[model samples]
Target: MSTFLLEIGTEELPADFARLALPQLEQLVRRDLTEQRLSHGVVTTTSTPRRIALLVEGLPAAAADLEEERKGPPAGQAFKDGVPTPAAIGFAKRCGIAPEALELRDTPKGPFVFARVLERGRPTAAVLAEHIPQWIGALQGRRFMRWGEGESRFSRPVRWLVALLDATVISVTLQGSDPEVRAGNTSRGHRLLAESVTIPSAGAYAESLAAVGVQVDRAGRAAAIRSAVLEAAAALGARPDLPDDLFDELTDLVEAPLLIEGSVAEQSLGLPPEVLSTVMRAHQRYVPLYRSGAASDPLALDAKDALLPRFLCIGNGLPAASDTVRRGNERVLKARLADAEFFVQADRAVPSIDRRDQLARVTFAEGLGSLLDRVERIEWLTDVLLEQLQLGAATGDHARRAAHLCKHDLVSQMVGEFPELQGIIGGKYLLAEGEPRAVALAVLEHYLPRGAGDDLPSSDAGAVVALAERLELLLSIYAKGERPSGSSDPYALRRAGNGLLQILWERGWSLDLQALLRRATAHWSQLLPHFSVQAPALATELAEFLRQRLVSLLEEQGVDGDLVQAVAGEGVAIERVLSDPADARQRADLLAALRASGELAGVQAVVTRAARLAEKGSLDAARLSPAGVVDAALFEKPSEAAMLQVLEQLQPIAAGEGAARYGELARALAASRDTLAAFFDGDQSVMVMADEPAVRTNRLNLLGVLRNQASVLADFSRIAG
Candidate 1:
């Protein structure tokens, strides 16, 4: 057995992309190796900000040998006069064997020519050399940079490639834009110190890099950065609000991790806390601090806390040696925050509402008109969703008001500077303008769950407004042919579509999705003059997209695929699925049970046949003959009368609700087992067929009705006995 090591050294990749892409790469490698029939190992995978690594231990030096069988045309067709013919010879050649290697075999389609061959195992190194390029090529990201244009696209340049089979560096070359590529025993370390280091084996890679100043473990690097920043803040008697995302991002930007404490200008403290925090984190990747003794003050940080600033940053090395770098970063952060503070104060003086008319200056999307126009379309659609939901008449006015003001903040200085803060700032502005809290939050949360597993709106009004906004974006963008492709979703349409479903599901309302969609899209039809792109008949297509999402959500919840096919087999009511008192697991069990009972199966078959015959409509009990009760003279045996009794007793009980109806009918059938056995033993088919046409039809109808009645509780045909 030998160990395997694969490393992909690349230029700095975006922190967020690295975090997601590396695990995917590891999984892909594991799957590929396993599929290749390489056994005997536990796979280990790891990622640093710059590279993704995989190590497999206990893997055999070569793949195991295996036997394979090949089939050809029938034996009768392949042989002529009891000797091998041209057809047989041709098959042998196709299988890479001589005629003598062929054999005869029996098959479902008479007999056929066959060949048994044993394949020899190849060295693991040979396999790795052949597969690595394809493996890397399969890796993708939201955005990839193509270096030198020779079909090489990665988040960054492929700086170094390390492939070791055991301790040997496998001989492999990558052909791409860079042209020259070779497997190597040496890899680079922290860019600041000992940038180039030799790695002897898979086991030595981590230690080799660490000794030269790089923390190859992303988690450790992150921990080191966080612990240092917090410790520095505690020493100053304050709290360090280290943003987790910013900390993660900074760790990836360097090979060696360093923790530094920096401060903003004292005069800048007058800005809103959120405004200041967003600017620092967004522009400078700094962790904000709160003075336990006093509010975070830039001057105090430069004074008593001078050694400890209002913001703490983790660079890639020691602060003493990087003084110029530290001071320079601080100056840049202060300037960004100063601009933020100025924007906030200026926007307040001209409040976003007063600037609403100015929204025409801002284009939400080129050719799609301005922010003001999108708001108008959204406002109109909001009314349609409200009407479909039959919300209080007051809701229409509120939705319109919320929609009109939702994008108002896009023009505000705070939002203009930081696009991520658009909805948040809008919400704040609404509250300040004396709008209701619900309306304000809707403005903010209508874009709730900007991504998967994110929060959703909690109020009905909020949900309604959210649905309207998302549908508008989806229709408008899809009309422009800007839909997400492969792994890229530039407009975040997938997230928006998902968020719309989540809000409806969480709200547990049975609003008619198709109707809501029709109304919403109809409103868009009128709003096209405001759009430059020909609206791509997207309203209907988008509705189907949402239905597909709902189906997926149901499947994930463990609903029976068949039941999902049956229930949602047609159009699904969003509300019914959300309101199912029995969770998905329970519904799955019920479906399984219904399809597992023998009596249920028999009953379903009979009922289905009867239903087809009486396709006109259901027959009333009055229409059924009282004299039609199994007559001993008309009945073939006691069993026929017994089945009748069971049917009559169950018909009414099965009309009731839930498991009780199912249980009671099952008991009724069980009770009549002996009689039904006698009736079938005597063969009642003769008597029923012997009756007059009307009488026979009535008898069959009675049997049909019995089958139909049993079907209500469960599909007997699906039951397995």
Candidate 2:
């Protein structure tokens, strides 16, 4: 066995692109080695802005030969008169065997001839040498570019390649201009600090890079960055705010990073702390420093007046130029802040109502009309949602106003310059213009939890508007005949769907997006007369789409898949797993837990059987008709009478509300198990399919009510057990 390494060097790549491509490169190499019949242990891949390297430990000295069974013509046909026919002879030749050696085997289609064929595996190096270059070329990027007149594509121009096995160089090119430099032990380090280092062997790759001021291990590099920034901020009596995303980018951006703390120009301190922090994060990709009180708790950005005039910077190279770097960066930020301050002052001079009018001319999407039209739809949808969810009346005025002005700031000069500040800037502007705090907060919260695990709207008004925005966009966009197809979600319907589900889950709102989408289509038809209206059909499709997301949300929380399926049973509008999302999840969790305790089988069986039988009848078509009605005059057996009594007792309890409703129903059903069991199986068993029509119909309807209404909380029909 030998240790292997492959280092791909390129012109300084974007931090995000490098981080994304490294894992891909590693996985590709591992897959290639596996397919080549090479035995190897752990595979490791790591990247810096300029390089992505892979290490495969304990790889085989040579590939292993594999044997496969090849089947041929039926034995009856192959051996007519016990002689090799042309088909039999050709098959044996293809398998590298003589026809006489073919063995007879019984298969589904009768007896067949089979042969053991050995496919010789090439030597490990021999196989890798032929495919490694193609493997490297197979790696993809966010966007590809062909550099310097070559046919090769990469995120950035390839510079050098180092590929080795133990002490020998692997025979593969990284696919670029350099052909003379065979893959070997040489690797470059820290662009302007260390020149180069010769790796002694694949195992020594990390140590060699570290000696030249580069940390190859991502965790070690990130730790060093955190320690440096924290220490620097502590010295200045400030705390550094290190968001994971930015920290990861910084780790990718530098081989030997240095932390630089700089002053924030006292004049700029008067600006909103968010303005300062935004400038640092979005434009500069630096962690922002915060001023903390005696307890070392960083003050909120909302504590505008108390913000300290200091910031942090991460320099990618030579620490000797830290002061120069800090001074240059400070000057750049000062100029940007001055521009921002000017925009803020100019923006505040105009009222939000005036800015709201500007949106009338801004297009939201191709066929979706203008931002002004979209806002009208959202405002209308917000009203409908609030009414549907039965949110308090006071939320209506604030949420409507917030919806009206949510996109107003996008037309502002400041937001135009800083696109990411759209929602945050809108809220700030609204507040400065003296809008109600509820309105301002709603405007800000509408874009809540922008991505996975992001915070949701905290206030009811915010949640209402947020839900309105996401629901309206989903319907309006789909109406334009542009659904998210594959990796290209040009419209982030997935994210919007996630936000919608999140709002429902968080507030336990029973607001149905299916109903909302149908209403939204009506709203859009009125607003954009020329737009094609995809109604009730899209509503069904969109509901199923969102339903899948609901299942995913529950599964993410560790609920079993069958449990989620069971809870979401029947189909589409017939049942909704998200009618009261939190409650639905609650029911799913409780039911799943009870079943896992091995206690629900008896009751679950009764529920499943009733549902299974009821489903075969018109109870679904006439679902509106009240079920479980029976002609007591037809009751002949005591067992049948007892079961009827149990059903009557459950009717009132099933109509109850609160967390205990489903639990109580479950207990009641479990309690009636023996009686129903006897009624179905006893010698005096009531014939559910009796010769008399009315009598048999009544019996089925009795069970129908149990499946259709009693177990409506969570469909037991869908439960796997």
Please report, in order, the local distance difference test score of every candidate based on alpha carbons. Answer: 0.68, 0.78
- 245-325 per-residue lDDT for model 1 (tens digits): 777788777667777767677777666566666777787777777657554421121233322336777677654667777
| Candidate 2 colliding pairs | 566-718
- State in Å the error of residue 527, model 2: 2.5
Once fitted onto the true fold, the runs of candidate 2 whose alpha carbons sit more than 4 angstroms away are 65-121, 173-181, 230-239, 291-308, 389-393, 512-517, 534-542, 569-586, 596-599, 615-628, 656-660, 681-695
> Model 1 segments beyond 4 Å from truth?
16-40, 59-154, 161-167, 173-181, 219-251, 259-273, 287-312, 319-329, 361-369, 384-397, 434-438, 474-497, 508-546, 571-721
User: What's the true lDDT of residue 412 in model 2?
Assistant: 91
**Model 2 per-residue lDDT at 28:** 80
- Model 2, 1-721: lDDT tens per residue? 8888888878888878866777787778777787878888988888877888888898887888889998898897788798998989999999998898899989889999999988887877777678767766888778778777667777887777887888787777554553333676789988776678898888899999988878888768888988988898788787677788888888888888788877778878767677778888888876777776723212222434545677777787687889899999989988888898998888888888898999999999998878998898888888888778776667888888899898899889888888877888889878877888888888988999798888999888999999888888888887787888779998899889888888877887766555666676666666666765656676776777777777778888788877787776445243355455566677887887788777688988877777777665555432312334676788878877777787777777776677677888777887888887877786866767778878777777777776755555566766675
Query: What is the TM-score (0 to 1) of candidate 1?
Result: 0.68
For each of the candidates, give the backbone clash count.
Answer: 6, 1
lDDT of 1 at 583: 30
